[model samples]
Structures are given as C-alpha cells and as structure tokens.
Target chain A: MSQHISFVQREELKNKPSSDALGFGVHYTDHMFVMDYEEEQGWHDPRIIPYGPLTMDPAAMVFHYGQAIFEGLKAYTTPDGTVQLFRPDRNMKRFNQSCERLHIPTIDEDFLLNAIQQLLLKEKDWIPTEEGTSLYIRPYVFATEPFIGVRPSKQYKLLVILSPVGSYYGDQLSPVPIYVEEKYIRASVGGVGEVKTAGNYAASMKAQKEAEAKGYSQILWLDSKENKYVEEVGSMNIFFKINGEVVTPELSGSILNGVTRNSVIELLNYWGIPVREEKISIQEIFDAHARGELEEVFGAGTAVVISPVGELTWKDQTIQVNDKNIGPLSQRLYDTITGIQFGKTEDEFNWTVQVDEVRV
Target chain B: MSQHISFVQREELKNKPSSDALGFGVHYTDHMFVMDYEEEQGWHDPRIIPYGPLTMDPAAMVFHYGQAIFEGLKAYTTPDGTVQLFRPDRNMKRFNQSCERLHIPTIDEDFLLNAIQQLLLKEKDWIPTEEGTSLYIRPYVFATEPFIGVRPSKQYKLLVILSPVGSYYGDQLSPVPIYVEEKYIRASVGGVGEVKTAGNYAASMKAQKEAEAKGYSQILWLDSKENKYVEEVGSMNIFFKINGEVVTPELSGSILNGVTRNSVIELLNYWGIPVREEKISIQEIFDAHARGELEEVFGAGTAVVISPVGELTWKDQTIQVNDKNIGPLSQRLYDTITGIQFGKTEDEFNWTVQVDEVRV
Candidate 1:
C-alpha cells in the first residue's frame, strides 16, 4: 500500500528541552502526520505538517458523542544510533481493533506504519538518547463531522504526534502502591473495554483521581460483572507470581491486549517459566499472600515497560508484595525488554522494527 | 446570579433555511455562548460570539482521552411567539453529574442557565414556529489541555450551540423497530452509564449501527451483567405498559436518569395512571406479550419525547408491538409533553422556563 504522503517542514524548529527535563507528554517534536476520512472519499490527503492546533467545528461529533481511539508506542535510539520501535505492528493492529469497535474506518496498517517511519525520520533529532527517555508516539483518530446526533460520524481525522518523555512513573524500577478499586468499574465484557478507545480512559479518571488522593499512583480494576476477578491496572496489563507459577488475567473481552504484555508472556515462555492466563481474582491474590505463595506482582505496558508492584490496598486490607521491593524476576524482565528496546541485548524474538529512510 | 457576559455579534447573518426543510442538527444559529476554565482563573471570560470552528491543539486531552460531556434540550416558539425552554435546569444539573463522573470541573447551574437564556434571547429569531419544529440546544464541555497522559486536563472549554431541528424521529408518533442487543453491552454497574457523557454514547455506536443494519432504528440495551433486565433504548428511556400498568427501569447505576423519563412518570401520576419503576426483564415483557397483556411500549427522551415501539426483534424471536401502530398512551404522553413545550396546554407542572430578554 503505497501512500503518497506530502511533507511541509517547519520553517524553524523549537528549542529542544534538556534530556533530563523530558517528562511524560510534556514536549512535542517539530512535525506530525495527519489524514482525513470522509464517507464518500474514505481516507485521503495523508500528509506530514508542522505540529500545531487543529481547527475543528464546534459541533464536531467527537466532542458530542466521543468517537475517538488512540495507540501508544515509543521509538528508542539504539546503541548503534538506530531509531527503532518495539512491536509497533501490534499497536497498529490493536488500533485497528479499536477502530472496529468504535465504528471508525480502519486504516491500512502498513500505510500508517510508513507514515510514522517517515515522520520519525524527519524528527530523528527529537529522539532523546538519554537512558530511560525516548520519543513517545501517539496515533489517534476522532470524529470530525459537524453533526449533533447520536450516531457514527461521516467525517474523521487521523493524527500521529510525538512527545519526548522520561519514565512514566518517574523511575524505571521503583515499586509503586496500587489501590484496588471496588466502587468504580473501568470496562465490562461486550463493551469497548478491550479496545483502546477514549471513553474507557475517560470513564477511569474519577477512580484514578480518588486513588491519587489516597497517595496511590495507580488503580487495580476488577471485572465489572461480578467485581471479583482481577482485571488490568490503570494503564498496564498485570501479572502475579504465585508459588511456583505466574498468572495474569485472561483477556476476557474487557482488558487491553498490551504489546508489552505479549512480550512479557513470550519471554516467560522462552525461559520455560510457568506462566498462565486465567480468571484470577483479587481475593485469590490475598489468599495466596496468606499462604505465603505470593511471590511477585508486576505490570506491563509500553510506557512503563515493567512496573513492579510494591504494595496493594484493597478496601481495608493492605498487602506488601516482595517486601515492597522489586523482585529479581521483575528486574530481569525489565532489563531484558529495555535491553532489546535500546539495542543493548539480542533481538531473538524479532520484535524491534528499525526505521529506515523512505522516499515520500 | 448576575453575569457580565460580553457579546460579539455577526455583522451579516447567514440566510436561514426554510422551516420545513430543517432536519435534526442540520442548520445552526448565528451565535454561541462560550466559556473557558483554568485551574488558576476558574471559569472566566464568558462571551457570545459568531458560530464558527474552534482552534484546538492536536494534542488536546479531549482528542485522545475523551474527557468530554454534553447535554441536550430544546427551545420552542410558543403559540404567542415567546421562546421558552423545557426543563433546561435538569439538563444543567445532569451536566454537572457528568462532569463529576468524568472528573471535569462543575459549573454553577444557575450561571449556565443564565448563559443559555441570554444566548437564546439573541437567537430567538432563529427558533422555528412550524408545527413539530423547534430549536435544539446543545451544551458541551471538553478537556482542551495539550497533554497526552491518562489524566484529567487542567484546561477546559464549555460552549453552547443551537440547531434548528424538526422532529427527532421524522413523525413524532411513528413507531420505530427496536433491536434487542445481547452480544454488546452499553453500561455496567460502577460504570458511567448513569451520566450524559460522551464516552457512553461513543461506546454505543457500533451496536446502534448493527441494529440499523438489521433494519431497526434503535437498540434496546439490557443490563450488562445479566443481559436480561431492560435498561434503555438508544438515546431514550424505555417504559412498558404491562397489563394496563406502566413500568420503567429504576435508577440502576448504569442507566441514565433521563429528564423526560421523570416527567413521564410524574405525568402518569398526574393523570391517575398506575405506574411503577422497577426491573422489567425482556423475558417478562415477552411473557406479558404471551399473555396478551402488553398494552404499550414507548421510549422517552429530549429528542423523541415519546417513541412508540413498533416491534422488538431479539435473536430468533420477533414480536410485533401493538400491531405496528402507535399506542394511545404513547400518543397521549407525546401530546402532553409537546403540548406543554409549545405552550398549547396549561403549564400546571411549571416545567417550561421562559427566556426573558436580559441586560448584558
């Protein structure tokens, strides 16, 4: 799928932030990629232009009915100075799944990947080389139709923006406390929970705020139906090491299929570690802790890579995982993933995709 | 509350469409009310400006995280040529509820009411006086901060726009076929189902489209957990008159607390009709039909007022409601509501709020 994407470079690039000052989603690159979708013309006019504000109609359907979807990934500067992405194809495919669920038009994944590569090539200097810092790629689509009814939009826009960022949780290996949410639900089966749509995140902001107020950094969500089985964490897929085996929640239709999650599972399989995906409940984790079988707890996502859970507070009960420290296995998974991401280790899984210059 | 709202009038007004040609959400009025919110200044700079597109950053949190909410009501040209609104206070209150759920800051309901009234006075000439025609009012707020993380935005914008709309369902009394959705869920307990936020509507488009594909105009959603008890129809609250008694779904956490639904319940009480709010399962509705006691089925909302259900198709079973004709009770409710809205009937309920010309 060859897409003729036009490029309009910025006249003067903005001053770059210091590498050490790069925080999550705080700084943007010089240019971005954009495409438009109309019911009759489908998607067209793919272009890379200066990063700026978008002129949207006040009655745009997205602002009214919220038909928006997004994907999150990162580009890292390898030791050999090569800019590469980790499982971007998976992000694109999952983005398509979100589009399907949100009733938005799906894009040609290769076309989008090419667009990202071209944009990255143009903004190559923006990729921070400092350890624990990279360029975060956010590809999102939203309804742009100037209508006010409760229906799918006829017009849409797809945009890809880049932001230089540090560690999502301020540290690569620091174990953070997670609040087990019981009152508020994130997503339910037969809904858009499995897809990375905007509403699911919007619906979680309240619980996240309350958790933050209680000094917790993130939330551990449960199944909406029964509120018994454990789901994913705020923005990552969760894993628990119990006794001699590891277990994560099955993708029971409401959990996000994280690319980093897939990598962690594959890495465990490659190491011949006992890993399984099934309906694991929060009470079960507490029970395992009671039985001295709760070995470790960690979260996996593109932003954090691997986040070790130090403590978990559910209602009135609190349990500390691995003595409120990063477990050895968690450290190994983080090192292996980041090692491959930064080109410091072997790419045996063939997961990294190097960006090469391509003619527009 | 006295608000010092500034106004910027358009020098040349656009030509208005014929009243007969006005469809739902097709044509907009000349001016709109706008307000901004910042953590430092709170909500400031309330103004009325020419209707136009909004310039927003491509990284605006609303575009990605969908922290957007909106309310819908209508303004009618009474028989005496006065423009008035129907229970807009309820919409404002509900808008605050949505804001609380989405973690967006709330606004003073009276101040917003005044803003809407002031905007309506300026656009009063645009209100359609034709039979079954009125001006639809849409007030919405969204996160405008240019950030990309999974958190509530620090900056926001609230705007009110007007659209001259005909009857929401073409003929107000025409019954619409409803598809009973079992595979896809709309909202679950502990979700944002009870609020009028953009995510809930965005999460519903695929199911709505699928129902349309199956020749149904709307979808009747059941409880997400059990998928048995009826929740609501698309964009409306549903009620069933079984064995000559009207029963609607209670304020379950996942169901919207509709203003029109409340008005209907009150109206039924005013008319001495046996009415109750309880869990009405689809199977129970089917059983009522089996016993030849399903007297009427209708949906109530700001858009449709009272939409008679012509048929219900659930999996393999298809039931024709009232032989595909409008029921008497549905017609009476529509007449009473629209009558009060247009000032043709006695305002015994004091539901309509008159828009008075105010000093800026």
Candidate 2:
C-alpha cells in the first residue's frame, strides 16, 4: 500500500509530564494517527493530527450498539535510543479477527502496522526512558455512522494514540490477590469472548468493581456453563504450576488469545519446562493446593506482562500460592519478557519491530 | 425531580422528510435532550439542544471500553391531535436496571421522564400521524471520560434523540421468516444479556447478518450454555404457541425482560388464555410441530410490537408457522397495543402517558 499519510502538526504542544509522575493511560503524546472508512470509499485519508477531541454525531451507532474494538501494544526506547514495538503484527492481526466478529470492515494489517510505525516515529521523543516505563500504544476503531439501528455500521474511524505509562501494577513483580468470580461472566462459548472488542472490557467492569470493593486487585473468571472450569483473568490469560508442570487453560472459544500469553508458552518450551494446555477446573486447582502440589499462579497480558497471582478467593475459601509472594518461575518469566521488550537481552525470538527514524 | 431543563432551539430547522419516506431511525428531529453526569455533582446540566454532532475526546471511554446503554420507545400523535408516549416509565426503570449492571451511575428516573416529556413538546410536529408510522424516541447513555483504562468511567452523557420512523417490518403486520441459530450465541447466563446495553446488540450483529443473507429476517437465539433452549430473537422477545397454550422462554437471566413481552403476557391473562414461561427447548418446539400441535410463533418488542413468525429454519429443517401468515391472536394483540398508543381505543390498561402541548 502506498503511504500518502498526511501530517497536521499541532501549533502548540503540551509540556511532557515527568517520567516519574506518568501513570497508565493518563498522558497522551502530541499527535495521533487517524483513518476514516466509508461504505462507498474504503478506508482513506490517513493523517497524523494533534491529539484532541473527536466530533461525532450524537446518534453514532457505536453509542447505541457498541461496534468497537481496540489493540494494545507498547513502544519501548532501547538502551541505545532506538524505538521499537513489541510484536505489533500480532496486535494488528488480532484486530482484524475482532473486526470479523463485530461485522466491522477489516483493514489491511500490513498497512495499519506501517501506519503505527510512522506514528511512533513522529512521537518517538515522547517514549519514556524510565526503568519500568514505556509508551503505551492504543489502536482503537469504532462505528461512526450516524444511525440508531442495531446493525453493522457503514462508517468507521480508526485512531492510534500514544500514552506514556509507568507500569500497570505499581510494583511490577508484586503478587496481587484475585477474586474468583462465580456470579458474573466475561464471555461464553459461541460469543465474542476470544476477540478484543469494546464490549468484552465493559462487560468485565462490574465484576472488577465488585472485586476491588472486596480488596482484590483483579478477577479470575470461571466458565459460564458449569462455573467449574477455570478461565482467563479480567484482562489477562492465567497459568498455573502444579507439581512441576505448567498448565494454562486451553484457548477455549471464550478465552482471549493473548499475545503475551503466547510468548510465555514459547519461552517455557524453549526453557525445556513441561507445559500443557487443558481444561483445568477450579476444584482441581483447590485439590492440587490441598495436596500441596500447586506451585504458582500468574496472569499474562500486554498491559501487565506477567502478573503473579498471590491469593485466590473462590466462594468462601481463600488460598495463598507461593506464600503470597512472587514464585521463582513467575519472576524469571517477567524478567525475560521485559528484557526482550527493552532490548537488553538478545532478540533471539525476533519479536521486536524497530521503528525507523523519519528523514526530514 | 424539579424541572430545570434549559432549551436552545436550532436557528433554522431542516425540512422534515415525508411520512412515507420515514424509515426507521433515518431522520432526526430539530432538537435533542442531553444531560451530563459527574461523580461529584451527579446528573446535572439537563438541556435541550439542537440536533447536531457531539464533541468528545478521542480517548473517550465509550469508544474503547463501550460502557454504553440505550432504551427504545415511541411517541405517537393521536387522531384527537394529542401527543403521548407508550410506557415511558417502564423504559426509564429499565434504563436504571441496565445502569446497575454496567456499573454506571444511575439517574433520577422521574426527572428524566419529565425531561423527555418537555423535549417531546418541543418537537411534537415531528411525530408522524400515518397509520403505521410514529416518532421513534431513543434515549441513550455512554461513558465520556477521556481515559483508556478498563474501568467504569466517572464521567457520562445521557441524550434522547427523536427519529420519525415507519413500521419496523415495512408492512406493519407482515410475517417475517426467522432463522433459529444454534451457533453464535448472543448472551449467556451470568452475562449482560438481560440489560439493554450496547454490547449485546453489537454481539448479535454477525448472527443477524448471516441470517439475513440466508433470507431470514431475524435470528432466534438459543441459550449459550446448551444452545438448545430458545432465548430470544435479535432485538425482540420470542413467543411460541403450541396446541392452545402460549409459551415464552422464561425471564432466564440472559433473556431481556422486554416491555412488549410483559404487556403481551398481561393481555393474554386478561383474555383468559393459558400462557406459561418456561425453558422451552428447540427440540420440543420441533417435536410439537411434528405432532401437529405447533400453532403460531411471534416476536414482541418496542420496534415491532407483534412480529408474527411465518417460518422457522432450525439446522436443516424449515417449518412453516401458521401457514406463513399472521395469526389471529397476533393481529388482535397488535391492534390493541397500537390502538392504545394512538388513543383510538379505551385506555383500560393506563399504559400511555400523554405529552402536554407547549403553552404559548
């Protein structure tokens, strides 16, 4: 695809926030990448414009029907000052998968990836250099059609915005308590659970809020049917170490296919650790813990690369894993993934895509 | 609940479309009612503004997380030259119910109803008086906070827009062919299926589109767990008549508690008809057809008060319902409902709320 990406520089740029003061998704870079799609003319008029408000019809379909999707990835500043993205291609591909499910028009993955790279280059200076901070890239698409009917929208807008963030969890490797939610469900089989759509996140807020009220950091969802089999966490894929083998729930139709989760599995296999994917149940985990075989539990996702699960409260029973501390394997996995992301370790996996510097 | 609605009329109103050309949700009235909500101030700044675009931050939470919900009701112009709304209170109550599930802050229902009534008085001319046409009123709420984190947004917006719409099925009483979907579940138990949220509608679009491509008007969704028992049709609650008894899938947690469905149940009881709400499996319906006891099937909702199901295609078998025509009972229910809405029949049920004229 030809790159006719237009640019509209902001007349006045806002001062960057201090790196130490940066929080997750709180501050945005100066410019954002935007593209519009209409039924007659496909996606066109790609541009990099000032980060500002969007003018939309009050009757846009997205407000009423929620036909929206988003991809989350990060851009990191290497020790040597090179900007690179962490497996952005996967995010782009998964974005199209979500589009297919939501009945939104799919975009050219390669073209969008290139657009993000260009967007990163323009805002490269905004990438934080803090030890635990990076630039969070949020690529989202939503229905822009000015109609109230419940159907696929004929118009859409895709935007890529950058936010400087410190870390998802205040302490990166600190283990957090998880509430095993039995009352609310995030998604179900034959539903849009596997896709990264807007609704999936919204559907999780109630449970998350309730869990937070109970002093839990996140929710560990169970299957909607029997409410027995373990599913993914609120925003991450969960894995457990039982007796020595690492096991995560298989990619059931209702679980998200996390890119970070995939990388962790590959790394585990590379390290020659025994790992398997199966339909493990909550009862089985409790049984394994009761038998003193459950070793560790953790979650994997982009925002929080590896979140160690310390305590789990299911129903009336609460169990602590690894003495309510980060397990050795969880710490190692976190270091390895962050090392790969920050370009400190060798890129043997060839996962990082370097963003080229713009030539004036 | 004091009335404090401020108004700003459009300088020049757009010409209204002809009543015959008034398709569903295509044309908007000259004005719309809007309210803003902040955590500290609660819902404030209720006003009627010109129907136009809304300025929203690009990173608004609704576009990314989809914490949105809406209610659909109608305003009708009676033959006596009075304007009234059908069950607006029920819609307001249901709106709060949806808010509770989405973790959104609830609003004052009585105050909102008063606001809508005042807004209707401003745009009463837009209400069509055609036999099958009426003003479609859509009241919606969405997250407007410009943060990208996956949590309940602190800021929100509520808006009510009016669109002059013709009959939902084009022909008011025409029967529509329904495709019984064994795949692509809409909502599951312990999920947000019962709420009139944006995600539920977006999640059902793919199934609806595929059914439409197969020459079906709407999809009849089965329960997500078993995919055997009937749940609902896309956008409407479903009912089946076998032998002499009318049956609807019970208000299973995943099925929407529709206003029209409730009214139908009440009317059936008033007429001394046997109606039951149970978990009626698709197999049972098919078996009932095989035994020559399947009498009729229809859908009920605000859009189509009584949509007779002419045929149902489940798996590979297609069965004609009531010889592909509207059932006598379906016709009577439609007449009773529309007659009450338009003030042509006695208001024995006290369903309609008359909108007072704007005094000069």
Candidate 3:
C-alpha cells in the first residue's frame, strides 16, 4: 500500500559510455526496479537491484504466450541540471490499460510513480545532458508463471530498467520516406492494437522489414477492413497537414493513443491551429497532394517526439510534401515540444515532473 | 555442416511426477537442447544442457518485442518399447515458415531434427508410457539480443524442452460447450493467425477468458471481416458434420494450418468419407441446425487429438448438436487419429518416425 524501497548494489559498477557514443538502449544503468505478483500475495518484494540477467524457466508464460506489456518514457536533464520526466503519469495510465487487455493485474499507480522518483534520483548520473540525448525508462510487466495454457497466468513480474539513448533519428529533424504497406497488417479493430503490448510490436516486424528493403525508413499502415483509411506509422501516431487543417486518425480501437500524440494535439489547439482526429483515408491524402494541399506529414511518439515526413510512396505514385524539406509548422511544433521537455520554455501545461523535488 | 552436439549433466536430477499426475508443460526432463545465433555465426554452439531456468537480460527482445515462435508435437512410446515421433518434419517445416514471418533466422532442419533425436535419447526415461500420456516436445526460438528497436534481432536462441504431459483434455473424449465470440476479435487476413508465433496466442487470451466466464469451455472465433465465417475453435481447427457431409473452413489466410486437422482430413479421405474444405459461415451452420441438418461439431489439435462439441452459444442462442452427445463421425475420427498416434492403427501415410537407439 505504501511506497517501498530496497536496494542491493552491484559489487562493481559497470563502465559508463560517453554521452556522444551511447545509442538507444545499448547501454544500461546500474540498478533496476523489480516486483513480483502472486494470487495469494497481491504484490510483494518490491526492490531495486543490480541490473543483470533474469533466471527464468524456459516454460515461463512470458516467453511462450507473449503476455507482456511495457511503457516508454525518458528522463531529461535541464540547463540547471534538474532531472525530470515528461508525463510519466500518462505512461502509467496506459500501462494499466495494456495490463487489463493482456489479462495481467494492474499496479498501484501512485506507489509506482513514487518509486520511479526515487529510482530517477538513484540513477540521475546516467541521465544524458547532450543536445537531444536522454535516459530511456522501460517499465514492463510480464507473466512469470510457468504455464502453457491459453489463458492468463497467476503470477507476474514488474521490472523497470534505464538506458542512455541518443536522439531517435541520427540526423535531427530531417524528413524520411515511408512506404504504404498493402499486404501485411499491423492491428485490426477489437484487437490489441491500441494497447502498448509486446504482441502488437511483434506483429509489425515483417511489414517494417519489407518497407525498409524498398528503401523506406518505416511503414504507413491502413485500416484492416478496407485497407484505405490511414492508421498509425511504425509504433507512432501519424498526423497529416492537408490544405490547412491537421488531420489524424481517431482512436478507433485500431491505433495507439500515444502520449506524444496528445501533447502535439494540445499544442496545436493552444496555437489556434485547426487539428482534427477523425478517419482520414490514403486516397484523400493522395487527392490532397494532387490538388497541392498536402503541406507536411509527420509522426509522434515518446522516442522520436516528432518525425517529419518528406515523401510517401503508394503503389507506383510518390508524393513529395513541402518540396521534400521540413515544413515550417513541423519545425515549430518540434521546437515547442522539445523546449517544454527540456524545461527551457515556460511550463504552461504543468507536464514535466522534476525528480529531485518529488517525495518518495 | 555436420551433426554435432555437446552435453552437460546436471549435478542432481529433479524428482519426476507420476505419469498420471503429469500435467501439460509442468514437469521438465533432465536436459534440453540449446543453440545460439549471432549475426556472424549463424546458429552456433549446439548443446544439450541441464533443463533449468535460463538467465536472460532485462532488455532481451523476447520479453519486450514478443519475437518468439514455437512448435508443438509429442513423442509416443509404442507397445514394442520403442520411441517415435509423429510428423516432426512437418513441424520443422512450419517452424521455418513461422520464423520467416517473424523475421527471425531459420534453423537447419536436418541439424535441428538430429539434435531433437539426441535430446530424446538423453531423456528417454521421461517419456510417459501410459495409454493416453506422452512426452510433449516444445521447441521455441526467441530473440535474445537486448535492443529495443522495432527490427529483427541479430541474436537469437533456440531451445527444445520436454515435459512429461498427461492427456490434454482430462475427460478423454467428451463433448463440451463453446461460445461464439462476437465482440473481441482474433486474427484476421494479413495477420499472424496462420503462424504459431507467440503473439497470436497473446491476442486470444481475452476472448478465451470471457468465453470461460460465460460457462463455455472454449471460444469459437469467426472471421474478422464479417464475424460470420467460422475460423477456428479455441487454439484448434474446427469441423462440422452437416447433413452427413464433413465440412471445415478452408485454409483462409486467417486460421492456423493445424497438423491434426490435416491428418483428420487425410483420414476421412482414406476412409472414403465426404469431406469438404470451403468457406462455411456461422449463419449457414445455424441454418443447417434449424433445418435439423447439422449433425456434429468438433475441434482437432495435436494436444486434444479430437474434441467433440456438445453445444454452441451465439448471441444468447444455444444450439445443441447431436443431442448433446458425440456423433458417429466425430467418434470415428477421434478413434482413428488417436489410434495412429498411439501406434495401433496402420500408418499408411508413413507419418511415424522411429527414434534410433542411442545412449549418453
């Protein structure tokens, strides 16, 4: 019921990578947070221990059944050297939604948030202070129970690990090509598409690989039923600037409600820019491009924040947006979101949670 | 290039349960087959080591991305005191297909099959000799690399574990009620439903749990497009006897190509029974039942062999089949297939693979 903290440090700390050299999720921090769940004991033995390999039974349900859910956010360092997390509460809320969908038990959000604050303090040194670098936090809950039946397991394990990651895109704020996937589908309605679960990601590798092989960086998925309406991009929510209004697909239980997607929408509303979350079709986008109304297309997520799109290739037709350059609106939105994230701009929405001042 | 295997014995052997008490995937054998894969070294270090917990990194791709695929087959002991496998080559072939879909590297089928034979020899005593019991062989490949990008892992681990499993269904050959899932969808076209990947099972837990709560033993999933065409029953392929015609849904892109289902079709052909594989919708099935044309409904898989369905509930409408008892066709199919499995019937198709005698 209360925030519990226990620590057992490593005998020797691992060498840290230079801020410039660290890529995404390649280097890990010193300690990690872990908790276990049982049918009898609600959740027990919450502790932070040395980051290492977990000795798991080969029959563990997590490896066999794919009953696992995860949340991704980042710890950022400001100019004044204050460590903070942006909208971690949103990640926790979505994590519970994924747990419910995957048939895993939900955690006490308040207890977890408090524990995260203490963990951030403990690993504060690992938070990257480079221009676009940050410490990535991966909180995942998986079925640890060793069973093979096609049902939920009675036991689970919640683990939180940290990694120093560079900017998601090597070249910052540049536009890239995305292929319109016609054969492989990501998630259909009434499926686990909207949830940030492991299965959703596994179902998408083939499509991503095919698109990459065709010289596209990612894929643009469509609705499974008609294969016309545009869905989310590769693990990120997509937005299209058509004519003047910014259009995005609604949360139809077939696409993820990304945290960064919400922030972008809020920023657009504040700026009095027309933004709409409704069904948008690939044909409509092509028509808009034909009429020279398509301005810019971009993707939003915790990792990239905003990924500008330069060209979209569908069938045999390719359309270049904003003359294959980063549009003005995309650059402004990126600067605003990242500025608020790094605490350089005024916090009007109170989204950033500072680590050192929060009570554990 | 050649068949090679290293062995490591456990310091102490674990206690084995009685053959009758051995549940599915619970008790393990003394040793297992493990092979590692790297980008440069394609599936190296083949060994059979002590069966125990596997030490995995916290960020291992399997736990987070669900990039894992598996095969389910059993090793049976005959009256002649000889051990043999049933259609393991088919399982290996399917395993490669699953691997291709999941973007994981495939194994050398001959080398892996040779390794499984050696592993069975190493733990020959664990194979259950009871009439309905057999050693369940579970071979799985999972992403071992600890990176968090949405791509194929450069590193992977393939492991084969044996569990002395009892009969999958305790009642042997009995009829049970199944619910027709209308709300929660399973796999659809262009999805991973046809593959034995972990994500497909993960996507079905919610529907299965809901069906079980409604007093049904399993769920009968309809096609994702219209929710009318019958896709599969629980995790098995389904069949129906309508007016003396044995019918099953065709190999649509949305259902698993069950090995037992294939065998059942072959057996029906061999027996000179009328069997058809085509699009059979739930409405047509209901119409058949209304006109007293529906005779029986059943499910088939390697685990259950054949499961007779007594009743089906759709939208609060329950249809009892064959007076809530196993029909003649269902009974005949169950007996013939399980007969061949236990080595009683003639294997005219040459489905059995006898294990060569070897000792550690």
lDDT of 2 at B47: 97
Per-residue C-alpha lDDT of model 1 across residues A1-360, encoded as one tens digit per residue? 676999998999999999889988989999999999999999999999999989999999999999999999999888778888998999999999999999999999999998999999999889988887889999999999999988899999999999999866555589999999999999999999999999899999999999999999899999988998999999999999999799999999999999988999999999999999999989999999999999999999988899999999998999999999999899999999999998899999999999995211
lDDT of 2 by residue, B241-348 (tens): 899999999998999999999999999999999999999999999999999998989999998899999999999999998898889899999999888988898888
| Model 2, span A39-115: residue lDDT tens | 99999999999999899999899999999999999988888888788888899999999999999999999999999
Complex DockQ per candidate: 0.89, 0.87, 0.76
- By TM-score, the better pick of 1 and 3 is 1
Candidate that scores best on DockQ: 1
Q: Per-residue lDDT of B179-205 in model 3, one digit per residue for the tens?
A: 998887888799898989888887888
- How many clashes show up in model 3? 0
Candidate 2 — which residues are off by over 4 angstroms? Answer: A170-172, A358-360, B170-172, B358-360
Query: Root-mean-square deviation of each candidate, in angstroms?
Result: 1.7, 1.4, 1.7
Per-residue error for B138 in candidate 2, Å, reads 0.8
Of the two candidates 2 and 3, the one with more favorable TM-score, higher being better, is 2
